[model samples]
Target: MRRAYSVETVRAAEAALMQRLPEGELMRRAAAGLAVACGDLLRRNGRVYGSRVLLLVGSGDNGGDALYAGARLARRGAGVRALLLAPDRAHPGGLAALLAAGGQVVDGPDGLGVLDLVVDGITGIGGRGGLREDATGLLHTVTRDRTPVLSVDLPSGVEADTGEVHGDAVRADATVTFGTYKPGLLIDPAAEHAGALRLVDIGLGPELPEPPDLEALQYADVAALLPAPGPESDKYRRGVVGVVAGSERYPGAAVLAVAGALHGGAGAVRYVGPGADAVIARYPEALVHAGPPSEAGRVQAWVVGPGLGDGRGAEAAVADVLAADVPVLVDADGLRLLDAETVRTRTAPTVLTPHAGEAAALLGTAREEVEAGRLAAVRELAARYRATVLLKGSTTLVAEARDTPVRVNPTGTSWLATAGSGDVLSGLTGSLLAAGLAPRDAASVGAYLHGLAARHGSDGAPVSAQDVAEGIRAAWRDVRAG
Candidate 1:
């Protein structure tokens, strides 16, 4: 698992580590890593010796890292220049070191003629809101030529804890983070601003605490969590998933949801809705029913609300599914009918999958607010409903009601923004729940597989929901192979 610590935690860890090391030793270690990363980028263009490097120095340690790194490049024969945003506030020691190494300080933007690369050290993790007007204007002028940018620690102007980008922010071609990943570098909105991420260990692991603020699962982690059949395993032993979806108006949703469930690790899929005939046509293996979910017979888990439109029957169906003692997943139209008290009172584990719009309605806020602050929105929903919440979008986040690390999915692609795609995810996660995985694990694993499947199905082209379901087997194979 890839762990991300909050700014407070990282600061504490850095402080603790700095105490044990000699004076300026910690900063030297960080500068060494930054210099190597800068050299690598310069090498790709030609060589570091003749590269024109520019540093955006601010009034913080981040600026110190940049200044020291500039000195390293200068000693290596690179023409390095520092554009100090705050001359008086700049790291005095670092500025002196850069000048001693033959690096010059440019008075203003006009002196920044041409550059091979730009190092963004305008703000650190502690800086919030966005870039100041002066920094923003200077950044705009520098980036007008489309010079590749390398942001130190993280892209300035993005919240390190919440991944929210307010006002003006630096968009970097790549970000060189230290010690560990930040929540802003992993989550979206802010994540999008960070093109590529590179982590440099400054040996803060021993100082940091267990159970980081956020985590992202890798291939090996997902492989171990995946379910496989044994020689003595039977259909019932594997698990059965019940899907209650689709209305007369949206029968295709039922078929798509069943498609995802069939591909999931479930032994059998039992579907109950008005779209029974359509599901039967697509998948004869699914057990179909036309009445309420109560009459749908035995199921280890239930997935409700894919295409059930607004109606009296739909409401009753959602209520009936919630009453079941099995693990339940609620999505789409079902999200609209959920009662916070009812969900909180459930004895069985409940998972809520909502997009930004749906999540906003549940939280009584605007969609834009949820989109801006996804980490907060997802955590709030999980706490309020007392259930596992999956906030789906550019980055799929799974948060448990308890104080555990939130899982951020890294495999998501833009191709997943299609009709019925979310319905497929709902059914897939529901199947995992039936397979006896905990709500949080099921949600995380489901998102991982869902994203990989979408990539396989799309493969640089447009893909339908059915194509994504078909790609599940391939995704499973790939994960196992690794």
Candidate 2:
């Protein structure tokens, strides 16, 4: 798992580490690491000698890292030039080091056409908004599509904590972050600006807190979380998912949801909706029920609201599921029926899956606000609803209530944006809930598997929701093999 800390937490850790060390000791360690990363990049481009490197230096410590790294590069025969955004306020020690090493402070992008690498140090973690006027001009004057740029700490202009990129931000080939990974480096749209990332340890880990602010699961982590069948496991012993989905108009949603549940490690799926005929026709293995979910026999968990329209029956289904003692996953149309009373009053664990539009509706805010500030929006929804929330977008984020870390899904692709895809995700998550994983774990694991399955189904081409559901088995095999 890749853990990310907030800017405040990072600052606290850095402060604690710095207090026990000599003056400028932390900066030197950071600079040395930065120099090594630059050296590797220079080596990849051919050699450090005769290579032209551009350093966009500002007034902060970030600029100090770049200027010092440039000095080290210059000593090895690379032609390094610094373009200071704030010439009067530049790091005095770093600038002196650069000049002593035979590097020059340039008026403009002198070798912009022939530069091999660009180092962005215009803004640090504490910097706010977008690039300053001078920095913006410098960035626009020299940067090209093929340039290999490395950002110091984080790409300048990205919000270090929230991952919100307002106005213009530097787009880098790689980001060399110190101490720990910031939330922005691991999330989009700021994460999109940060390409490859390199962590430079300055011994701040021991000073940091135990739990991270956010986390992204990798293969090993997901593999460990996956539910496995044991020797004594039987149909009833495994888990049963009760699905309340589909209306007369959207019968395909019922079929798609059941299809996802079939591969979610569940023994059986009990589906109760008006689309019983369509579901039974598509999946004969499903235990179909035409009555209300209150009378749908036994089930470990329930997944309500896929294509069910805004009607009295849909309301009853949602109410019944929420009233159950077992865990519940609410998605699609179910989100529309949710109120502060219904959501917060439930004693059982509740997981709400909403796309940006649905989330905006639930929050009584605009969709643009939710999209622009996804982390804040998701976190707020989880707290407000008093339930775990899976905000589906370019990046799928699962935010839980309390002090737990937010789960940022790294496996999702644009191909999973097809119609009914969310419905599939709902069933899979619901089944995982029935399988006894915590609400948070169930949502994260289900999202991981669902996204992986979509990638397999897509294979670089457009894929339908059915293709994604069919591809879940292959994804499962790959996970087990890994």
Top lDDT: which candidate number? 1
My TM-score estimates for the predictions, one after another, are 0.98, 0.96
> Cα lDDT for residue 124, model 2?
71
Question: How high is the lDDT of residue 230 in model 1?
Answer: 91
Name the lDDT value of residue 376 in candidate 2: 97
Model 2: residues >4 Å from true position, as ranges?
A: 43-46
Q: What is the lDDT of residue 337 in candidate 1?
A: 85
Poorest lDDT segment (10 consecutive residues) of candidate 2: 138-147
**Which clashing pairs does model 1 show?**
none
Model 1: weakest 10-residue lDDT segment is 106-115
The list of candidate 1 runs beyond 4 A from truth reads none
Q: How well is each residue in 231-296 modelled by candidate 1, as lDDT tens digits?
A: 988777788999999988899889988898889878999999989889998899999987689897
Give a tens-digit lDDT track for model 2, residues 244-329: 99998898989899989987778899999988898888889899998688898899999999998886678878887888888999
- Please report, in order, the local distance difference test score of every candidate based on alpha carbons: 0.92, 0.89
Collision count for each candidate, in order? 0, 0
